[model samples]
Target: MSKKPNIIVAEDEEYNFALIRIIFEKEGMNILWAKNGEEAIEILNKNETIDLILMDIKMPVMNGLDATRIIKKINNNIPVIALTAYALPEDRAICMDAGCDEFITKPINRADLIKTAYKWLDQ
Candidate 1:
């Protein structure tokens, strides 16, 4: 059996975070939520158990790109996937440059989202 993986989700939107939390919970994955980049970083720095991260791009205090950069510096082995409403090529490039492993646009497709998370967790 696959062991439960710890997922760190950073989303400023309350409803979005709740939806993701419900989905992951139903799938039997453990989750940690952060309302913004700073809080996400705090959680990450304090918790050594995170297996993967789903980071939202636009947020107050700090953004996902900045957080990804910092998190990568702290733990290069952990993977971070970017989630954003920005679907532009430049946006994707920016996320890539900041050290995100993948980019998934907002208004997320449920199957795709779950698949991406599971695939990374399996790896």
Candidate 2:
């Protein structure tokens, strides 16, 4: 059997992370939580097999943009999806410039989240 995809979610809000955890876990993906961008980097450093990252833009310790930049330097192949409350065009552009493979805004929709995840995971 193929191994389940492992995903790291970099989010500072407990409630948001919990919601995402519920959604991804239900889909049989292995979920790892990072409360900030720094923690996300730590997780990446330790776990070499992470398949994707759901990065929150406004994280406290280090913002998603900075983290994404660092992460891209580490592994450009692993897809990083930006999760933000900002839906402005500039926000999207900023995320893309920071090296995010995809962008998803806050108050995440269940179907869209799953579809996006599958798109990146090639499932």
Lowest-lDDT window of 10 residues in candidate 1?
1-10
Best-fitting candidate, measured by TM-score?
2
Per-candidate Cα lDDT values, in order, are 0.92, 0.95
Per-residue lDDT of model 2, residues 6-116, tens digit only: 999999999999999999999999999999999999999999899999999998979999999999999999999999999999999999999999999989999999999
Error of 1 at 12 (Å): 0.6
Give the per-residue Cα lDDT of candidate 2 at 78.
95
State residue 48's C-alpha deviation in candidate 1, in Å.
Answer: 1.4
Q: For each candidate, C-alpha RMSD in Å?
A: 1.0, 1.1
TM-score of each candidate structure, all chains considered together: 0.96, 0.97
Residue 69, candidate 2: alpha-carbon lDDT: 100
Instruction: Tell me the tens digit of each residue's lDDT in model 1 across 3-112.
Output: 78888999999999999998888989899999899998999989978899999999999999999999999998888999999999999999999999999998978888
Q: How much is the lDDT of residue 102 in candidate 1?
A: 93
